[model samples]
Target: YFIIQTLAAAMILFASTLNAWQTGHWAITYPTCPLTTTIITTAIMMKLGAAPLHLWYPEIMQGATLNTALIISTWQKIAPMSMLYMMHKNLPTTLVLLTGLLSTLIGGWAGLNQTQTRKILAHSSIVHMGWLLIALAMDTALATLTLALYILMTTAMFTSLNTTSTKTITDMGTTWSASPTLLTLSMLTLTSLGGLPPMTGFTPKLLILNDLSMNHLLPLATLIALATLPSLFFYVRMAYMTTLTTPPTTTNTKYT
Candidate 1:
């Protein structure tokens, strides 16, 4: 991980230097909207596990401990957003729109079959990034608010999970019976994750859709928002499995 981060930093420095030299500006002014920028940005976003480049996230999450997965889900994931913000104006609206829509669709659909908890969250992050991409494209105050809200919500969720002692889904067997309060909170968190109404998660998605619709992007907004349903379905399924399913005979009665 240290090596990976070091290499990533070096590559980013090189890329920034190249962009600045070519554009005669320090902010990546030149070729930001060209094929070069798109390829680089897309590749970086992929490395960060955002949509279209999201395949790595789930696999990595599965390999890591829950706390490590939480770190990846929160702090590490924000790099792409920062990169997008830096070259905000340079991103093509059409490309942003397409990537956002595709991410939501694929993330949601692929999450359906996943039984592992970490993989579920990995895909959920991809779905959320879809909304984030849409907000970035819209470039409105409301969109900005939505993005901030999303970051906050995700952070809160990660913190809550990190505080838990259980390291895997199997460790959480019959968790509700042992700790009903935590179980309820877990349900609430997952519900929020799916962007259900009244939760912090839903707020941003709603705001993004409204902003897009007001800007005459109703069809696109509707489609992207609807694409979230598949991810939502699986989240709901996980919630049910955790709470509704009968406990296994081997299930321990304790959370730890």
Candidate 2:
């Protein structure tokens, strides 16, 4: 993991060096060389754990503590994604679209069989980043808004897990006994994270899809939507475990 992080950092530095060599400037706002721009975008994509370069994300998150995992899922994404957002206009549309689609597909598929809660959330984060990348290709403001909403939902989820000390789906199954209110809120949070209707998480996706359709990206939008099914399935499974399952008879206290 350390080696991977070091390599990613080296890529970022190499991209910056290219930027400096091409424009004789230290700023990333405007790059004169096309290769430099492409390198920066690719490096940023890798840093954000976009698909094809996201192999390290789940493993790292699974090994980290809950608080560290929370930081990796939320705060660590800001700089690279912000860089992507800043350079969206200059980036290659085809590359961004492909990356987004791959991320969505892989993110969803990867989480379907995972039992570790952090890995599940890590994959969820990748899926959200896919949506954000797609939105960024069309509208930066929309992408920023989507990222903000994701941060809120993810924070709510990690906080719930932290409070309950849940490390896996099995641990989550007994969470209702710890605190029914927390379990209920966590269930709602998971539902919202699944991007279901009437939840805050759905709003950004709806707007992004609407924008995509308006922009004649209906096919891409449809594919992204379909890729979310697996994620939604696991999210509902977790919620069911936390909220609907009856406590075992061997428990000391009943959850009423």
Candidate 3:
């Protein structure tokens, strides 16, 4: 991890050096320096945990404590995404589009077999970042809205999981007895996270898809929608574990 961070910092420094050399200024907005812009966007993409460069995110989140995991999944995303937003117009459009598509596909595919709740959420974060990237390509306003909504939903999930001390799918199966109300809320939260209709999560995705289609990106939009199915399957599986199973006889009342 230390090596990765160091490499990322070096990439960013190299980009800055290139920008300074070409434009005789240290600012990030160099219209004549496409190479510098590309380098900076590449670094930002890795920082955001976008696909083909996202191998560390799930493992790192898995190793963190719940509070630390929550911070990583939510707050840590802000800096890189904010940078991406600032550079959206200057960055390479094709590269951003490809990164978004691959992240969407890989994030969902990688999480399907994970039992660890934190890793599942980590992958889910990557998937959401993919959507955000797509939206950023179309409209910065919409992307900002998506990012805000994602943070809200993720915070709710992490808080509930922390309260319950849930670590895995099997641990979630026993959550009902501890706090039925929390379990119920978690189901709705997961449903929203899956972008199911009539939920808050569905609203942003619907808008983004419409935008993509209007922009003649129908094929890409269709692919993103299809990729979401795998993620929804896992969300449903987690919901089932939390809500469908009966409480064990040895259930504790401490959380109730």
Candidate 4:
């Protein structure tokens, strides 16, 4: 695939640059340490839509159906996580925390004004990955647990949305009279995506914050928490629009 090849080419280019930068007088030393590893891993993760580089995902997801979006969000996005795990020993803590913090802030802020359902979910995914990146600096056991839980929660939400072909909060709210259960679940899922407790999304967020604090990255941890507030606020707004807002007159309801 073009994407895979492009990624390979990028990796090669990055490696070449690193070699050129860190090379000795006549030879090159492939750097292998926590700081180097973290930088490399974080770069790769950004390439894979890890955090600040996550701007493309929502727009791309919006262009696809639920099935395709699910694949891209789940299986396809795992490449970076796989890379992170493989290079865990060398990952830097400071860079990881910074990436996580920035990702969370940007993602949540960007989602605040979105009206399109897919864009909202796309931004939500970015925020979730931000949390995940933060969690990666924690113990491996916790990271795995967080990832697994994220996959399940996201999958369930997407599956439900796909089943009904729901694309916007208005689409959901107006149709609630037809399927209350779907609307309710969608609300619950939105809140869950925002990292609210009593759902699966909370664990990863808690773990990320806990890990960051333990590592003495308390400021970063606090920023992540603050960032999540925007995510929660926007989703709650969407929920209110979907479940409580009265329908307005529309000559045509077709997506455009």
Candidate 5:
């Protein structure tokens, strides 16, 4: 991880120096500098934990406390994403699209078999990053909205899970005894995180897809939409565990 961080910083620094030398400004002004732009974008992708370069993020999140994981999944991505947002005009659109799509797919499919809640949320963060990237590729304003909504939903998830001290899916099954109200709200938050309709979380996704289609990106939008299904499944499964899943029924123990 240290090596990865060092490499990313070095790449970004080199790319920034090159861009500044060519344009006399330090904020990625040279849109035509493909090599520099790609290097800088890739470095940001690494920092943001977007896929093809996201393996470290989940593992790190898994080991952190709930508060630490909350910050990791929410606050940590902000600066890197801000960089991407600022450089969207110079970024290779195709590379961004491909990476974003791959993130959604990887985050969704890999998370399907996970039992650990933190790992699941890590994947969820990756999936959200994919959407945010797609939005950035099309419109930075929409990407900003996606980031805000993601922070809201992710914070809610971490707070609810923390309230019950849940670390795994099995732990969710027992949360009712800790705080039943929070358990119920946690179910709603899961659905919102999944971007299901009528939930606030769904709003950004709907607007992003609509914008993508308006910009003639239907194929990309369709693929991203399909990629969300697996994630939604896992979210629903967690919701069920939180709300409806029942423990073994103990018979009338008067006889025992």
Candidate 6:
């Protein structure tokens, strides 16, 4: 990861230098600087953990503690995304759109096979990053809203996971004994993360889709909506384990 960061730094410098040489200045507001925009955007993509450049994000997240994972999913995103936000008017629309859609697919599809909580959330973060990218392309204000909702939902999730020491879907089963109320809330929060309706998490997706339709991005909107289902499935399964299942046990807190 350090090597990648080093390479990314080099890429940023090269892109900046190219932009300077072409325009006799270092400003990038000109958006059509060809290769310069591509390199810089790609570098930012690496930083944002947007797929297909996102493998390292999940790996690092899975190994870290829950607190660290929270930082990675929320705080770490701010700088790169800020850079992207600044340059959105100049970014290549096709490149941004394709990468954003791909991220949603990869995050949703790959997460379905996981039982580990961190990995699941890692993929969930990628999916949200996708939405953020798409929103970035459409409207920076919408992107900001998407990002804010993601941070709130993820913080809620990781706090719950950390509180109960749950590192896997199966671990969630045991946590209900520790604090059933917390576990139940965690279940709902997971659905919110999955962008289920009536939850705060659903708000960004709803607005983004509405914006997309308004702009005649019907095909893109449809694909993204379908991609959401797989992620929602895993979230629903987690909710099932935490809230729905009646684990076969015969122990009481007051065994007299």
- Leading candidate by TM-score: 3
Question: What is candidate 2's local distance difference test score?
Answer: 0.88
Q: Write the per-residue lDDT of candidate 6 for residues 1-256, one digit (tens) a residue.
A: 6776678778988998888887898876665577899998899888888899898988988999999999988998998898787888889888998899999999999999999999999999999999999999999999999999899999999999999898988877777678868977898899899888898989999999999999999999999999999999999998888887656676667757
Worst 10 residues of 4 by lDDT: 24-33
The lDDT for every candidate, in the order shown, is: 0.72, 0.88, 0.89, 0.72, 0.90, 0.89
For model 2, the stretches where C-alpha displacement exceeds 4 angstroms are 251-256
Per-residue lDDT of candidate 3, residues 1-256 (tens digit): 5666667778889998888887888777544577877878788778888897899989999999989999988998898887787677787888888889999999999999999999999999999989998899999999999999999999999999999999999999878877878988999999999999999999889999999999999999999999999999999999988899865677656864
| Model 5 poorest 10 in a row by lDDT | 247-256
Error of 6 at 220 (Å): 0.4
lDDT of 2 at 252: 81
Expressed as tens digits, the lDDT of each residue in 1-256 for candidate 2 is: 6776677778767877888887788887766677777777787777888897899899999999999999988999998887786777688788888999999899999999999999999999889889889989989889989999999999999999999899999888888789878988999999999999999989998998999899998899899999989889989989998888865667588679
lDDT of candidate 4 over 28-84, digit per residue (tens) = 133543344545664666555656666567778789888888877777767767767
Q: Candidate 4 — which residues are off by over 4 angstroms? A: 1-5, 12-39, 249-256
Q: What value does the lDDT take at residue 30 in candidate 1?
A: 42
Clashing pairs in 5: none
Alpha-carbon lDDT of model 1: 0.72
Worst 10 residues of 6 by lDDT: 246-255
Query: Of the pair 1 and 6, which is ahead by lDDT?
Result: 6
Which portions of model 3 miss their true places by more than 4 Å?
A: 247-256
Model 3 scores worst on lDDT over the 10 consecutive residues at 247-256
Candidate 1 versus truth, CA RMSD in Å, comes to 4.5
Regions more than 4 Å wrong, model 6? 29-31, 246-256
- Model 3, position 182: C-alpha lDDT score: 93
51-130: candidate 1 lDDT, tens digit per residue: 67666678878899877877787777667667777777777678778888988998898888776777877888888777
User: Model 5 residue 214 lDDT?
Assistant: 97
